[model samples]
Target chain A: MAKYSKFAAVGLLLAFPLLVSSDYYRHIMILALMWVVIGSSWNLLAGYTGQISFGHAIFFGVGAYSAGLCTTKLGISAWWGMLIGGPMAMLFGFVLGAICFRLRGTYFNLATLALAEILRLVAKSWVSLTEGMMGILTIQTFRSKVPYYYLAFGIAALCVFAIWAIIRSKWGYYFVAIREDQDAAEHLGISAFRYKSISLLVSSFFTGVAGAFYMNYMGFIDPDVVFSLYYISIMAILVAIIGGAGMIWGPPVGAFIMVLLQELFRSAFFGYLPKWISEAHAMAFGILVIVVIRFMANGVVGDWVKLSGLFTRQKAPIPSVTSGN
Target chain B: MEMFIQMLVAGILIGGIYALIGLGMTLIMGVMRIINLAHGQLMMVAMYITYVLYFYLGIDPYFALLVAMPALFLLGVAIQKYFLNPLLKIDSIIPQNQILMTVGVGIVLTETIRFIFRSDYKSVKTSYSSATFMIGNISWNVPMFVAFGLAVALTAGLFIFLLKTDAGKSVRATAQNKDAAMIMGINADWITQLTYGLGAAMAAAGGTLLLPIYYLFPDVGSQFTLKAFIITVLGGMGSTVGAIVGGIVLGIAETLGATYISMDLKDAFGMVIFVVVLVFMPGGLKELTKV
Candidate 1:
């Protein structure tokens, strides 16, 4: 009964906002949903598999470019563009995984960053396809934010459900085991490479679709925005760390909190601040993640669940608790 | 032939700076096994410090180094002691947590720098900052030469420090095997802190040294940081010697490749080296650590 009430409350909150939405609030919602998908996808790899990629923007760029290119150049439907983009991103993800998986520690991170930068450079220089740094203009932006809001929400829901399914399956267990101890998992007959790559593929698919979503909504696509390692990788890490990455609800919760915080700060500062402050604000967001992770360790959501268990008289069960230090 | 030689010389000069950047990273990674995304930010901060001394106080870039190094070294020590030491408590620190911790420090550092010192590009101006010497058909910039020379000097100093001092032995012992060294009455904490400070100081040195030639901005850290990382991997994760040599090779290869290969694919060429190295030999010029 309590669980049902909890669900009902959440449903009401979600439903109540949709009934009446200002353009500003609606814009915020569209962004929040978009991030939910991207952040969840990032958490899938960094949170679960323990790969710690700083190069996810490459996959996002691939999807955006592929989708954008298809629509503009070939005059293809976004439906077909998305269909092609997902596989294209997956293919790239598989190759990236296979290549960089051998590198232990920071080498992987550095290599991933380099690859993302390479993709950004490709998107910028290859004017014929990506339309250069000026980027793809005149993209299809809709009148009502409802379709975008729902599409983003649906994709995010799908990602959460997909990750949840994985958690229930052997694959998720393998990821957890390997994340804890790679050698031990290998000893236990789990192919670390295979599972890692599979998780990456799953992560990339959503990221690509999110990229497609981004191009459609923003009405402008640039190498900087699409290939922006700044947006995809750093923001994903922030969401994952803050929300207690590696758990089903981690990224979404983190994304909501972070996006909300940014909005609050940006609005609060208003015209009083300079553009540098705004850029610095993004950096501040990243710093907040680091500070929280440094101190909180298990991250915000992870800690919440842990703390809740301690206070409850009956060891109030909150599932796995995003188990961490 | 003239263009090729000029690029080669230029690459070698830039390679020296890359080596300097990689050396500090290798030193920390060898001991700590954590990636400091803040490495570049620290360097940027150091450069800004150097810039202030030079631009505001009218200190020479070389004298600014004296100020930058010690300041960064202390900042490095404090960060490691307060922030990183705690994070390194567990056996193997969580990869993502390390990312957050380092990048957290990085973002804060980068943002604070950008906040304090606007996004405008600041370069150290010496009469010699841009003065270039000509040799037959080849020209060499004084700032580049000084930076390159300093890179060599710093590497030598680091080698001597690691080899000569009692603390150096502790550092080496800890780097090789943390548990074994811990058993040997070596204070891993002290060694780790000192090593980090040393590494951070080296970055400050690089920052100040490269300030004349390279542009200083809050975001400039990302560029050198990424390049330093590539050099670190190419040379060897933990090998100091490997980093220097790898820096030169990478410098020359990419420099030459940019002209010979399509400039559009210049970055891809560097990435090609990374991918090739990872696939064929994950260690590149350096041997893999057995740990």
Candidate 2:
């Protein structure tokens, strides 16, 4: 039954484009799928490896710029970004890990954040290379949303599958061990730093791919859009946290919920509600983050049993507090 | 040489204000062992409060500090007591949930202010907003100089409170060791809340001081929040003395960077220095002074 449910879910996703003809819903799904990849990558590093990064935007923007630069500099199809973006992101990840992994806890988080800010500034100021704030624009291939949707779906699946394989492997144990207690893991002969770097490499690779995909899908790239600290970095954290950090299905579930909620609020319930509610979308996300962290720290997938328990009461009756006698 | 002196003077004056912001962050970090990402948003809230007082009632931004500081203290206390304090019990995978929560709170704060004031840049145009004074070859903005004096006085007051008072000692005790502080009858929870409140008040004071010279907007908090953390890290996490030194150093570095380097990359210099400090001088100035 469990296997059937999993297959059923996959089948539903595979057939989603065929089932839904509207571009609006399809666009939202593509975004949700992209987030799934990004969120899962973040979860691999922060959730599993215990090195919480406050700057996934650095990798994201790098992936995006790699794709954008391919078109302008190389004059090749932006589709080529899919091939190089992940590797480029991984290269950045290696350097970032070398610098940040030496530090622990808050220091690591801060370094990543500072680096992301630096990248944003560089992307903004380096006019000769990046065209500065003018941003890189490209003509997207394939007008239909189906191709993009399938591409997003494939990447998300590949990301999730790769992460699942890694987690089940011996390296997964090392990652978990490092997360639980780096010192204890070291005592057992596991090199914490090496495993952490591996985790980051795979994580950033998938995130970079997502970034490249975004460039292709959106057909435009800007430092503010891609490298935004609040929108990209923080949003990734929110997706992972809201869905359940350590669980495999967490980010996928989180991505869908977050993307849907954002669209719902952004459109003000498909324009049925007042326009003022549209402005409150960011605030809605803020409130959602607070509520989720406060109440559902384990997220939707991690706390499935608890969530289900709320709806389906137990058959066992409670004993009377006072004795009948 | 003249430009250098002018930049130094400007940096030092701004650094004094920055120190107040950093002091609050350092205090919260010391007590909670968590980075309060909302520190700048709290300051922004205070700035808005001051703006309201100044624009509507004709209250001076300096005098409005009295209202802004107390109000922010309450807001900070409420946040710590209600929102943050509860998280201590909720078992979760991420130990950084509190920090994440602060990010959320910061967003809500910024968006709420945005909803109320809109995104238009607002500034308190006091008579002294553009006034300047000359001391030999170097000139200092009048509002900035006055702000620097007030900031110094506030720092002195905070130092006295920290060094001389019972509550202040309890805060230090809690920061050092929560369990030990509890055993020593220090009510660690109350101290945590008090420290947060005090931190918020300090940030509020900084925002109020900066109002006359600096522009105000809803998103202004995030910029200062970054600046505050940079100062905190530069000062050697959780060290008040370190925060002061870090603030001044950062101010000077930023001023010089803006003057000499591309103005567009002014913010990058502080971040670069922050990363360098994290890598090489992890203990910040605190390690040098051994404070």
| Best candidate (score: DockQ) | 2
List the candidate 2 regions with Cα displacement exceeding 4 Å. A314-325
| TM-score of B-chain for each predicted structure, in order | 0.93, 0.99
Cα lDDT listed for each candidate:
0.79, 0.92
**Regions of candidate 1 where Cα sits further than 4 Å from its true position:** A13-17, A269-279, A305-325, B90-93, B262-268, B288-291
DockQ of every predicted complex = 0.53, 0.80
DockQ for the candidate 1 complex?
A: 0.53
Report the C-alpha lDDT of model 2 over B1-291, residue by residue, as the tens digit.
Answer: 999999999999999999999999999999998899999999999999999999999999999999999999999999999889999999888888999889999999999999999999999999889998788878889999999999999999999999999999999989889999999988878898899999999999999999999999999998899999999999999899999999999899999999998899988989999999998998888999989
Candidate 2, residues A231-250, lDDT tens digits: the string is 89988988998898987889
- Pairs in steric clash, model 1: none
lDDT, residue B52, candidate 1: 89
